[model samples]
Target: MIESLESHPPQPRPIRWWVRACFGLTSPVGQRLYFYTGVGLMAVKYIVEAGFIRLMTGRTLTLLDFVNPLLSSRMQLLQGAPDWAGWALILWSLPFLWIAASMSIRRSADAGLSPWPGMLVLLPIINLPVMLLLAALPHREVERPYGETLGADDVSAAGSALWGIAGGVATGAVAFAMSVLLLESYGAVLFLSTPFFVGAVSAYAYNRPASRDAGSTLAVVMLSVLLSASALLLFALEGFICLLMAMPLAALMAPLGGLIGKAIADQCRGRRSHAMYAVAALPLLAALEFFVVHPHVREVQTSVEIDASPQIVWQNVIAFPDLPEPTEWYFRAGVAAPIGAHIEGHGVGAVRHCRFTTGDFVEPITVWDEPRRLAFDVTEQPEPMFELTPYHEIHPPHLHGTMRSLRGEFRLIELPGGRTRLEGSTWYLLAMWPQEYWIPFSDGIVHRIHQRVLEHVRDVSERSNGPPSRH
Candidate 1:
């Protein structure tokens, strides 16, 4: 009997209610359960998020801030927050959002309604009323058969994959057109929402032909993004470096999209999925983000010690000779490197011209406290970098003014003996959303720029005269 039982397939383990509620694809959630559970979970999520934000920022978030659907106010809060806060909040709340979405979809099925309306839970402002409406709706006793044939077997796996890729690429192209070509935005909508929908739409389409396992869906979504990236490169729409820089953020979001896609595919089976139409919202969101949100100023400071006095270092701080051709791979890879600097006149009101491989920065001297501090306002700056692209060159919109240096200052602090501590700070604005993700790159690049200039100053000052008299 034991041998026979072993030979026979064992009974499938019963899924717990909580597990089904949280992650089940085919479970139908009744109205009373869905309403109370959703409300309670949402409340818990809000309280937890607010508490975390309070702890991280030392500032309390009001209920108004929590319920508001507008991105502007939320982004402003994040702007003031520590670099890790936004990312932490996102990581924290993703599960809540996922649970809410799943419950909504399942609740719709219980109410004998299209699961498409349930997807509104992912949208803002509208989601509140959607939940209320879903809660009020009475459950209908409809017995839907599981795993009913949807003609998926008719289409081959390779064909399904190809269709998914095409759909994903199309979605990305539309986003690129709206955000880059039309509105000239490099904000969160383009960076965050686009990748999400790309993964979602692609996964939905791929699974529409035949629903695959989670791992397969992830693979398909990743492949889709890779193809979309290739499309950008081959079409000369974006360069290698820009795309490479974007990859990390894109990678972070795309898998979540894939998971959502897979969820929709698994849950909304036998019903036509509304994922394609959902992608249409990308342009509208982009428009909203572009109009309401603007880039904020950020500062980066880098310091180095030199075996020279403040007076000797001050001379090089004002203007320096040509730097040798950059040996850094990033500089060689199209990031502009400082070549030389020249000053037209003496003291304050003098125009200091700093030359980079790409072009010049026209800086007007504001303070010229000899041997101590040097400050200037950048009136004009050239292209941040030349994009590494095929063909002659492609002038992507971001290269022009996305990153701007507003002002800069160099401080020379005298230390024991004859050595000096040189600190360089640049105040700039980066027109990118999710500042936490991009700030590090910007800060590092700026630091590199500072290092090149400061190091050159050190070499020159140490090798030359001890101290110079103020003009």
Candidate 2:
């Protein structure tokens, strides 16, 4: 009778209280409440914060103004946020979803199904009902396989501890790199899009079976082609265009890519699963295509005409220290200045240091261009406040050793109407972070700063011959 029982499937077990609670919480009504409440709270926060920023600035916030700070730390008006706040948010959010999924999986396991089937939560439009069904299902208690009779609590505790350690390290590394990129003035959009890759990988790993599906194969191939094309287009366009174009393209491609990956997996079923091999080969293919076919750097220029004579503007620029007053906001903020005090050389090899100050915080200049440009190679920064978690300690790197180059510049061109075209541009090669992670933020902030400086210069220079009228 025991042998017969073993051969027969185990009977379904009663659901535990905890499992029941999880099921209740993930019900359609509960999920709707959570989603809507979260959105409402986020909306409220944005509105309140935006209002406060506008009130402080005495000007209505433009979309760019509001978004710029969030995108680039260099533009951030908030003085004392922890460097790791962003990373911490990411870390904290992950465990919540993982736990919820685990509970759902447990409920599914009680229904005498493979835990892998719980991954249906990843499917679009179908996940809600699937999760609900999984949650509502009764649990089944079965005898454990040999060597698998460990205490549940102990196993869970060990897994949790491991996950925490790994998560902390990963979060810290990502935060550090992200902070560096933000400081360099990259955009936040690309950083925000990283979850798509995560989703795609998850789908590829979980949804593909050994069976071949034509639809899935077509989806994957088409998605890969679309993503590759979009990436190529972005590389070919200017920064702003790249940003504008890449966002919608990414949004469209990510879900499609996930579905395609799933389809590809399904197609390979019973045909000697090529999914693993495909995944392995993808990186190699990407690397080859990126390095050999793509242009990593393309240069472009713009000119802004200043009303002042080239010689006069050049004098003011070269003799920036002797100027009557600080004309630009950056200059007023003590972030940058004319060539005299900061730089020693008038040409390429001349070394000068420019300083950026925000209240008590100051960034030292590592590279100074005489008569034209200045660059701050940020070597180190103070430890962010929130990184002082009990579980892990973060130490700020020493500035002297950590300095990578930050580049900035100005160009002077003689124009008609006794005017000079003062074209300003800056460039820096980012290190300590993936270029994809922070380049958009960097570009947006740099562009804003450049625009501000030029506008200020134009305003001051244009009004120099008369009493400055308020615009």
Candidate 3:
């Protein structure tokens, strides 16, 4: 009877491409995720994008500049010369979105969670954290018809960990290379997407039976660090800076990625199952790069009501002394906080040099209505900020041209009480995508820059008597 029971363990029908069981992602049942399924899908996406970019620009994409949707202005697509890449990418992306949403809904239901969260599948870039979190959830104890629990014997950690990490590292490295080679960008590639790869590797590391939480956590961190270090050594990415910069970034993202990877791997029958989800993410990633991470112009304006008149405020606006040492952590941590301002002339056509720690922003006066308005075009841009880490100098891409300051203006509005509402405004374009994440930091930095100058103006204007009344 025992021999018969051993031979008669609960069995299900053989898996097929159109198998009903395959449609639902989550199940207590086991299913095999065929090898290379994930990679093949990603390749399809790469070909489509490369073709579109090449057709639109008459040049293949390169590892030159930040190549995200933000770089494609409507002028490139709608206005003067229509570059078809935008519309091409958009229309082609719909089917992939459908697939992602469907998979998410199935995955959510299998998790014993509502499918509503699966709505995140439709959102790009941001949806990664949500889905990864979902992936980390353990299966419900109660079994449904999905295929008998993943079977007690899963791939041992000893066997799967190294394989998963190696595969995940290669995958993430490839993705990074694609971002640079295929898209010519880094922010979304590194900060936004790499975590998943780290997670994949970590997931593999934790795949064994009876895994310890702390040990697993350390394993994930070490694997993520290794992945980052390897990128520098093998691929010529950010070099030593990655030890502190990339490692911290990896530490923040890899643990999460690992959990999700593990969850995906656990749900599937084979050790390589996580790649399927990673592959599916490629289309979503593309959608994000083009639509969600698309670049847009951002303007920041900050105003302060000063006790003195416009003439007094205007005097200091043209030229100011050194700023007090920065107390804010953001500034101290190497963001190029404003130091002072001094100009070569008094009116329109004069050159104004605004100094920051990294370097000076050369602003040539464009409009000057004495005591009321002062506008200037940023003729020369400087590094956006510096990394605080000990180094003679660091040159991160975003610091170079990814963030550009186009123009700036000061509007001095005379208030009722001899007070002047001194408004300092800056127009800029952040080349990076994932605006929702980066905007807050950019906005705050701009505000502080404005504040440093405006507050200095307020102090000097109020500190001294009113400027000689201009006719």
**What are the RMSDs of all candidates, in order?**
8.3, 18.4, 13.6
Return the top candidate by TM-score.
1
In order of appearance, the predictions have TM-scores of 0.81, 0.35, 0.62
Tens-digit lDDT string for candidate 3 (119-192):
44443455546555555554453333222225335555566556656666665666666564455564545554
In order of lDDT, best first, we have: 1, 3, 2
Error of 3 at 394 (Å): 2.0
Please identify which of the two predictions, 2 or 3, would achieve the higher TM-score against the true structure: 3
How much lDDT does candidate 1 score?
0.77
In model 2, the number of clashes is 22
Candidate 3 residue pairs in clash (backbone atoms < 3 Å): 29-146, 29-147, 70-294, 70-295, 157-208, 199-257, 199-258
Estimate, for each residue in 1-471, the C-alpha lDDT of model 2 and write its tens digit. Answer: 224333544345355743444333222212222233333433554575556545444334454543332232221332222334333333333333343343433344445454334543432223455655664454455443111212212223234333323322232223223433323222222222232332334344443323224344334433443444343334332122323433453444345434433433332222332323222322332232223321122112235677776555554443234224446553453222322224444544544443233111122445444434433433332211112122332223312122222344457766666666787655434322223323443343345545654655665566663433332
Worst 10 residues of 3 by lDDT: 29-38
RMSD of 1: 8.3
Q: Which 10-residue window in model 1 sums to the lowest lDDT?
A: 144-153
Candidate 2 lDDT at 253 equals 35
